[model samples]
Target: MQNRRLFLGSVAATAAVAGLSACTSMGGFSLTEAVRRLLQLSANRAFDRLLQPEGFWDDQVTRLALPDMVGNGRGDVLARILTGPMFKDRLAHAFNRTAARAARNAAPAVAEAVRGIGIRNALALLHGRPDEATTYLRGEMAGRLIDVMLPEFGDALHTASDPLIGEVMAALTGVNTAALANDLAVKADDAIWRAIGQEEAAIRADPRSTNDPVLIGALSVR
Candidate 1:
């Protein structure tokens, strides 16, 4: 079942690029191609900017720590013992490093979704408010990304050198491997969304960006 899902995810990604090829072959800037380019651009930009150890960790907004168990009995006690931000910072760094590594695998899934945009949808998006693309992407891609991220998160967690963090959490909060895996996957997804949103904002701000083929095609849709 897992293998099937992963296979399907890869297929979706391939399909996205296929859509791009098909549109490009049509020879003129069409709305579909525009949307494809925008989505592809956004995804590539996000990965490049946010899916690196330095990139992911440097962005204070996306760098996340383990959940604070401030009032949860033994969990709280352990949290206190963990104390200083350095340990948490190290843990966050490791978590982000894992996410960065796994993000490379998400390209296919992202591309597949870009292909899913319809002409009508593209027109709407072209005319919509500034952040519409980002919002649409979040809606369309989050669940798929979660499915894609889980296995990577699990593998990273297993290989990550954080025995003390894991030991404390397991001893105090009874967080087994599966729970940790899910948490990490969710965090990675959130980070991706944030990165995409940031890129979208940049796209909106650049007036010179109007010359981009995707933007040109999108605007011509009407």
Candidate 2:
């Protein structure tokens, strides 16, 4: 009776070990899947925000107010004449309103790209430095968006019945579109850096995980 009981106990222990191994393997797979989903979701969210009006305006961090190209103060004067004493305020508000509407209009294309790109590359980006992911996604999508938005924006600007608004856009026309776009791009980049700094600080303050080794290594190299 004793020997028989021993054999049964051994058998039970072996079965338990096998079950544990399977569970561990499954857990690892789940973690990988979760990481992938997070990346896709985060990337999509960032891109969608970029094309949104709030993304362009409400966030003073990413607002697209261009400097007066006509001259310092002169641009302000021009804005006033065209838009009235409230010209600067109105122009800024209109730019934000229009950009937000336009972003909503461009959302479909952003969605399509998220679905089409496999999750691996984007996941790697999320694990990377702060703006790395944004830069990659922007590079992938911006050209296509520009192709669509430029003509639409131009048409909208042209049809703007407000003479003051028309004059401001006309002044902008004399400047190179590429230069203006670059200025906007720089501001966006600055915003990303600010975000990254905030995120890094939050991570460091927590008593939980250590700083990301990968990010640490990259910073050392830099």
Candidate 3:
């Protein structure tokens, strides 16, 4: 990915002479090509940024409280109380720890999903919101992303929290194992996307800083 990023920097250097602008292109750059870098850059930076230990644990926006303990955003107050502070702390710690690992492990999945999303109206997206690429990605595979990472996220959660997870899950009756895992997966994926979107916005705001030709050419357009 670092090599590809450097290659893109070289590509940007030749932007003015690379190609002719067209309906489907941005500032003489193929919208397809530009979108590819835009998405790739965003996904790569996002995952790399969040892959650190502080990624989820420290980020106020992406932190996973599992605050609900079971039905976060699903409204399960009983689940929260039943889980208690010790359980909540353990689960949150475990979730955050595994979330960081998942961010790294799920990079390919993110890249594959980004590659699979065919940008139909390329120009529209190019001129859309700063995080438009990320919005498009969220719509395309947010759910699918959860599906792809769930198994791995679940496995990591088990490995990270093990005995505590076993004890908690065994004691927390009425809490479906699958649902809890799904919640963890959803939280992790959401955090990743949020981080990715932020990176996309940052690049769009200052494309020149990225030193990537495609983004510079594409976003520089009015």
Candidate 4:
């Protein structure tokens, strides 16, 4: 009896709070299946929230910083000027808003990727950390997402920002919109993945927060 109790305690202590794994069976609440569901739930919830109006801009967790061409507020005179009240309009519409809008198109790719995730060693990953699933997704899609969305985002950025803004950015950064887009793509990916991680953490802490059976089953103990 004592040995059984100790084994159960150890298993409970080491079980991952939440995660995903590779499999397709709809059987009982095995750890592997639960992990996979948590992953998909986190990804879908994060993306859905981001697809809303001003979703990226209003949510600090997912809001992206200004494009590299725009410069930070400290040393660069142009960057400082752009940070002033006069340029708030340009900055707001050009970056975060654009990212929020772009998420609509980018989401389909992300969803497809999420669906394709087949974590062959779900047992190992599920035992690591609550965010292991999100980390996996980021590694799998970060660069590919940047590549897939760059043109779309570049076009959106060009459309959102005025011609004068682009000219000023080019003058300061010596990079065209296409070049600037690479940096933006990276930032956007970081923000989105961060949002996914946040959702995973939230669900892990309180499975009831999501009302998803898989997430609740996977993480309720934690």
Candidate 1 residue lDDT tens string, 1-222:
999999998897666445444666235555556666766776778888766667678887677557543223275556664577776566666677777776777767787787775445665665566667767876866577878878987775565456654545455555466667777778777888777767666665662474685564344333
lDDT of each: 0.66, 0.48, 0.72, 0.68
The alpha-carbon lDDT assigned to residue 186 of candidate 2 equals 46
Model 4 residue-pair collision total: 3
List the candidate 2 regions with Cα displacement exceeding 4 Å. 1-36, 43-55, 67-86, 118-123, 161-163, 167-222
Query: Where is model 1 more than 4 Å wrong at Cα?
Result: 1-27, 68-81, 163-173, 216-222
Each candidate's TM vs. the true structure? 0.72, 0.52, 0.76, 0.75
Alpha-carbon deviation at 20 in model 4, angstroms: 13
Taking all chains together, the TM-score of candidate 3 against the true structure is 0.76
Pick the lDDT winner. 3
Ranking by TM-score: 3, 4, 1, 2
Which digits, one per residue and each the tens of the lDDT, describe model 4 over residues 177-206? 676778777777888888888888877778
Q: Candidate 4: what lDDT? A: 0.68
Position 32, candidate 4: lDDT = 58
lDDT of 2 by residue, 32-146 (tens): 3423333344444444555555666666655656444423334554646545446666666665555555555445654565455444442345445544543555566655555
Put down candidate 3 lDDT per residue, 1-222, tens digits, no spaces: 999999998786555333424533344457777887888898888877788877788788788876355534232444653456775776677678777876666788778877777888776787788788888978887477777767866685455356655555554556666767787888887888888888888888899998876678777765
* Backbone clashes, each candidate: 1, 1, 1, 3
Q: Which residue pairs show collisions in model 1?
A: 13-108
TM-score of 4: 0.75
